[model samples]
Target: MFKWKRKKKWYRDFVNPVHEFRYAMEFVEETLEEEKTKEDQILILDFILSVIREDLKYDTLTNIFYREKWFDEGLRISLPFPYHYYDEKGNMLSIYEDKAEVKKVDLAKECVLVFPWHRGRMRDNIKNIGRNEFQYDKFNHKAYYFSPVNICFVYNGMHSITAGIGFKKGYIEAAEYDVTKLFEHVYTDGLYWYNRHNNQKLEDDLLDFRIGVIYEISKIKHHIEKDAT
Candidate 1:
């Protein structure tokens, strides 16, 4: 007979104190892994930027998407960048579609400014829950959800890296800096703790890029439809 025993507080009964500690540790470990991944991403971005800075001839910037793999552990993710070009006036050029119409803008000449997207309190709550599953699952059986923070960089044809964050409006502008330095900072900081502890090497991975591009394209298409109205 498969009889389900119903306790007064099913959560409290099933989740023990020791189990809670184990869950907390797991969450901490996962957080460490995520940090390491972010560091690796920064490293790759920096490398690409350095190439851009060194050689001014190569002006086209292509979007890169790294596929996620099981072997990647925490180092697999996507990276996206716009096709960056320059005008005769030393202006940064980028193309974006507005309402089914391709629009070109000179970033350097335009007054357009980008701000970092606010990763709202809801996202923070999700992150906390992902880290503390034991406590979360005890209170509610619902699955945990987390919104990841994306770290981006701006690079010229030569190799240099500039750190920035994405926004709903567009990419935020970061200070011009070296790519290697960015990677070193991330590796030395709290980011790479888990990878170092686990003896893992960061790889160039970009699974998120593939997924995001599709969504972004779809959104652009929708925007175009809206603009035609």
Candidate 2:
């Protein structure tokens, strides 16, 4: 007689961290496929929008750069209603339903405005965790973030990450301006930044489109070190 071996659970403590992370991502992939109808095509964007809030078929920004994830001809996700609904006063009603919640329609009579939906899903995703595991704020300052370890620098002046954060955090926005300081990340937009104590405003940079994430996080490590000195 042969002795049978036990099957180890993937979630068992013995698994490596990297392997766990990869498996978690794969499980997310599998769930997207399961949540489909007979005629709908599944997409990767449907899964890793781990950050964005909408259950949209294709996000506008992602569709522009990563086109394959979206099915529509344009970046807009499919609206919940085939015909636009409005009150007697002509104000549009707010309805952020998924495609499943919507009714089939004859396009000739349908009208709708499918503006981007927002409920700040990213903030809800990582509201609480260990200090080593992060969200955005630290050292009495806030972070401009894209992903973990890809956050703003602790440097006391303006940098690319600051500009991006400034746009998101309400310190700055899309506009034309000139650069007076430099940072590790750059916004392709013509927007600019000013120092913490300065009252002056920057115009914009005509040439600042950047590809790839910039990591001056080594600078963050240095900032932490010098603060302790």
Candidate 3:
């Protein structure tokens, strides 16, 4: 009798988009069990695992790296810091630098405080309230459309960050006491917009830490992917 044997993948361990996702998570788990890590490295590994372990739709929704108008194609994202979304465009136009060494002051010096969320990109902050509602303050750089959905963008220093019940496809602006019990940390659960404010409700350390890990992972995935490629 003849039997079929499976072929092995030639890519780096836990690097491919397919089965590697599970391995990626395992790698992180093993890393944790193997030895202790610094906060920065922990942030990176946690994020990577969170993203890789998501379902398909949610995973696609989370890839908000490259910075460019919908028209740009040949462009791809490659950076250490997701200092800016559509980062390649930002780099070409001298808007945002992509070095890990750049301080928050550098971003402030350029008058850019925070980057907007791309397709499935998210923001990480610790607050008392919840709901994906962006504050409409003077420092606000992104443009927001409050219609059927919260559509946002940047044109000449206009960008947006939202805090509300928004879906994965668009943005929303909610109140401090607006978050529903949702899984903001699960990779494939899709993004459930949430932000906190001065109005205290409750605190879930695990949730906060997970959301933060998601941001750090999303921000740094491109750089890791580039390195692997």
Candidate 4:
């Protein structure tokens, strides 16, 4: 059995498309104030605006990371996080991470179910593996990995990562955010989009924390008014 305790709906302030847009602007503004060169700042701001424009115009807010060249080749890297799988009966079946993969099945003991529906989803993802259907376009599906304090976390694409493991494809292509302290903590199943699917509601802890961190790290001195042009 799975346990899901509902929390107060405090995510309304941070998780909507509008708020996401604001955060992106604030993050870009603060990033501009940093010690980056003039050219780098311009490049970063341009990319940020492009992402925001896409989101506002097309309703396609894909999480993307910055790169020197947006059309460059995709990265090929191993699954960077530990992935745990449990049976329907809540028994730990396997764990995959890094170069060394571990597969274990223990039916005699049961573990607490954090996500009741995740196992079913993983099964579906496994079907998509090795089908040559995956594409990581640099412009569209560029970046999903987050590294805060040097620890890598996947802000998106868990199913694909799990499926890649099942297919034994090491060193998959990926793009990472090479920032430190962008987020202090990466909670379990805390992303707004992920929670939106399961709870039929939005929770903005992940986004909230990120925006807060951006302010803290950057110490932005002046307010950035919304661009009217």
Name the top TM-score candidate: 3
Candidate 4: residue 22 lDDT (0-100): 56
- TM-score per prediction, in order, is 0.17, 0.19, 0.24, 0.23
Global lDDT of each candidate: 0.27, 0.26, 0.29, 0.34
Task: For model 3, give the 10-residue run with minimal summed lDDT.
Answer: 102-111
By TM-score: ranked, best first: 3, 4, 2, 1
User: Stretches of candidate 3 above 4 Å error?
Assistant: 1-16, 36-140, 143-185, 189-229
Residue 31, candidate 1: how far off, in angstroms?
40
Model 4 per-residue lDDT tens digits across residues 144-194? 232322222333454454444345443333333332221122112222322
Choose 2 or 3, whichever is better by TM-score.
3
Candidate 4 residue spans exceeding 4 A from truth? 1-120, 130-143, 146-150, 170-175, 181-229
Local accuracy of candidate 3 as per-residue lDDT tens digits, 1-229:
1222222332344343334334444565565566554454556564554343243213222234454433322223222111212221222211132111211111101111123343322334212113344343434333221111111212212123322212212222221110111122212211122222222222222222233334334434434444456
Model 4, residue 51: distance off in Å is 36
TM-score of 1: 0.17
Could you tell me the C-alpha RMSD of candidate 4 in Å? 20.8
Model 2 TM-score (2 dp): 0.19
